[model samples]
Target: MKKTFKIPMSILMVFAIVFSALNLSVFAEEKESNDEYNFELVQKDDNIVIAKATHENGDELYATLDKATSEITLEAVEKPKGLLKFGDDKTTKYIVKAETIDPALDVVDVTIIDETTKSELRISPEYVQAQLPVLVPVVTWGGRALLLWLMEHALAMTIAGITAYVATDLISDIRKSNKNYWPAWIRNNNVYIGGDAFDTDYQAVGWVKTANSGEYNLWARTEAKAKEAANKAAGTNVWHQGKPTDGHYDHYHPAKPLVTDPWVVKLDNHLWY
Candidate 1:
């Protein structure tokens, strides 16, 4: 006789309440983008470098730099809600003028004073152009929290277990029809030499393959040497016999080949015949 275990409904209710409370604590609050600025170089129009930043309300903040004078100015169709400053101290301000142009990697680097920290932070051109456009929708986070909460309930857990069991059996059925074999290129191009086989330097040789077939008769020392001698005569690199990994077989095929085919031991010393 087999025994089965069941979970009490009271414990499941406790789990649901705890999971919901944790989700609400983490994701209940709404988030907003700060007026804190960053910049990216969009394009260059003659001597002027055109750049763009993102506004908190999802609008473009444009800043232009003059190549000749090294003067940069920020211009937007609508004025920003929070005033943009350029330094750590609250007094160091950037209204319409900047001191100099420091360019790197085709992007101009600029410093901005964080409104909350009252500290200087540099925003690179790449960050402004490449990264700033990605916005996380608040609704997606709320939906994710709701999905997690539902997953903790008893009914949903039962459904998940059943689905997982069905998926495993389906995968096993799919794999039954498939067979594992070596790649065609390896079997077609390479030759196998093994059974205490040693090269000119007495180095243990493993598998040997001809670069060009029908040029030379490749040799395997023993009949047990993966593949029959008759298979070698057929002008194919592979054989019906399996590969051998006995003795100090060559791990790295660094030997100079006598033939054009670089027949030698290779990495993962196993040979496919």
Candidate 2:
């Protein structure tokens, strides 16, 4: 009896050790998958260029520009709230700005004003599976055991469980993808110039489209002329007209030209053309 028990016990111990080793291997693989993404701020004349590259372990790398001079300073800034997602991939963001040096020369002062924020997401699925050899075998054995216990009902129960697990995992992945994607919200508004400094006022009208949200938030400037233009463009009869008060312009309307598709309007007295 002692010899018979010893054989089974030894086999079980070996299996347990194998499973634990497999789990540890999977964990190590996950750690080794740290790829560093690269981001850079390039200053060219008056323009600052922002560039990014995908890598495995971006968080461990220092975020700094190679071209750090008195005339130009590159700084990386923390990724903005709502701009970053958790556990997708490593990412770094930098803010590059150019300032005027003097009215004398064409040379402008360029600087990176903030430290880049670095973040790392979850390990890749390939690594997770590659490291865990025992997981699949264990799950398979469990399924087999469950089927054996169920006897006549085994097939149906096993299939249902697998289907449910797969469906749940699919949904979770979809949600995770959605969370990681970021959509840009572009806004353009007409800057109302009052007759004088006291009359100076500003109005903005545009649409906001978020990544997750399907609907757009259409809004027009509240100033009198802006409001009228927006309403006229929208072909809507509803008008909110008010006079200039507290050193601002009167009622405004949204312009139809601005609301049209592929909307292009003058910004800061400068046209794209």
Q: Residue 52 of candidate 2: its Cα lDDT? A: 26
What is the lDDT, from 0 to 100, of the residue 17 in candidate 1?
Answer: 61
Best of the candidates, lDDT? 1
Please, what are the lDDT tens digits per residue for candidate 2 over residues 83-129? 12233433333232333212112122223223343221111222233
Error of 1 at 220 (Å): 70
Per-residue lDDT of 1-273 in model 1, one digit per residue for the tens?
A: 899889998888777666544424234333323333334556654355555554443334544445444344443333322223223421222222222121111222344333334444343434333232222222111212222222121111111011111121122332342221111111212332211113331121211343322221223223333233222322222323333323121111122223455653222223222
Q: How do the predictions measure up, each by TM-score?
A: 0.19, 0.19
Model 1 residue runs over 4 Å out of place are: 1-42, 79-273
132, model 1: CA deviation in Å?
22
lDDT of each: 0.30, 0.24
Total clashing pairs for each candidate: 4, 36
